[model samples]
Target: MGLLGFFTRKPHERAGFELYSAAVGAARRPGFFAGLGVPDTLDGRFDLVSLHVALLIRRLRRDAAAEGPKLAQAVFDAMFADMDVNLREMGVGDLVVGKRVKRMWEAFHGRAAAYEAAIDAGDLAALEAALTRNIWRGEVVPEGAAARLASYAQALAERLAPQAMADFTRGRARFDVEVPA
Candidate 1:
């Protein structure tokens, strides 16, 4: 409510950006593009980021601490803000930026829902299907590519589950799960 409030951010806001940073880094790891077969194009990269962010959000929402939901929302806001900046930087006309971001948000939402349901069901096939549909764009993927990505995601979730809520709130995200080559 003060003038400085405009200049400074809340702790959760910083934590959310940190978490988003981690997700972007994880998505850029070469293992995904070379080993697991995600395409290296812009859309492919965006999908990978979306997938990682979705996983992180899912983890946060399940946190035992009440701060989980608030942090999760922060992460979501940070994502769209970054996307908006990215679009403008890419020379997208301002008139279309909102529409583009809206479409991206819809894509993110669908991917998140599908991944969540599959993970909750413990169904690797369903996960693979979702990955193939979204990441691979329904094309015939390289052999076992989608399956490998699904395995990696499941393992990453397992790794994320044990991290303390405090680590996230302190902007110390840990996303070093081994990607199955």
Candidate 2:
């Protein structure tokens, strides 16, 4: 059986979908929110990462019950760690994506050991707010980060927003075109 067996998706299909979710989820984490220089704390309207995670978990629970629990947990695990690395690597600056593949690995898994799990619902919120404020902004990201992010977003839309994804994948999505120099 393959990874998709859990979702009744074909093996290859499931692989893409899983990567899509994982990447999308990571992109929405507080780290990502901070990347755009957004404030850490607010009226809870713009914390896209937390909002999406909550909604995703809720919807998954409603849709899949038992399986949703496992999936949600896995996503939470992966996102929290991925977000951390993305932030940490940015701190060193002068990044260029292609060069830090190995560093990305150590930061993703190893750095996770340094932080504690969310102790409570409120604690999670506070933690996210603090980290978002301290880490995402005021740091420089390596080259290709934007394209990497775009790829994840594209994959996510492909999986969840099939019609939109299809349009974008086919080069029909709306965007401002830049003329070459």
Candidate 3:
């Protein structure tokens, strides 16, 4: 590759990382665990991140612009790459890293599919059920927790869908800052 190519910023790459960062930011909102009763464990955190990323990807897929698909794929790739780094940092051995990453990918795909279906159906009940099953890991959730999270996800999706692709590519995509009480 030429020096110019090396130095030039790739729009999709920037957008992908931006989206992932946004997802992480949303997931880290303390209210999700404190007010909403989402477990504060590693798996719980992963579930939140997965949910946010799935919502972003869903919006990207629905976009009809020429760059949508490419950007979406880049975002997905960025997510897995982050997951790989995280696993390694947690002391996962090289020999099993590939297997662990594969499992994470499978989990992501499953969550994405379920989220897409619920969002498409436009049913809060379906969204709540999906969150309860996946994020809460099938345990009995505190009253209204799933419903609150479902509302948050729907609000986030609505906010993301109307954003211009250029904003995302420029690393200016925004998620709602207010966490549900």
Off by over 4 Å in 1: none
**Which of the predicted structures, 1 or 3, would earn the higher lDDT when compared with the native?**
1
The digit string of per-residue lDDT tens for model 3 on 1-181 reads 8778988856588778888888888899999998998999988999999999898888888888877777888788888999999999999999999999999999999998998898888988999999999998977698899998999988888889899988876656687757787
The TM-score leader among the candidates is 1
Q: Which candidate leads the pack in lDDT? A: 1
Model 1 Cα lDDT, one tens digit per residue, 39-63: 8888999999999999999999999
lDDT for residue 98 in candidate 2, whole number 0-100: 35
Q: What's every prediction's RMSD, in angstroms?
A: 1.2, 13.2, 2.1
- As for candidate 3, its clashing pairs are none
TM-score of each: 0.96, 0.31, 0.92
The TM-score measured for candidate 1 stands at 0.96
For candidate 3, what is the TM-score? Answer: 0.92
- Output candidate 2 Cα RMSD: 13.2
Candidate models: Cα lDDT each? 0.91, 0.38, 0.87
User: What is the descending TM-score order?
Assistant: 1, 3, 2
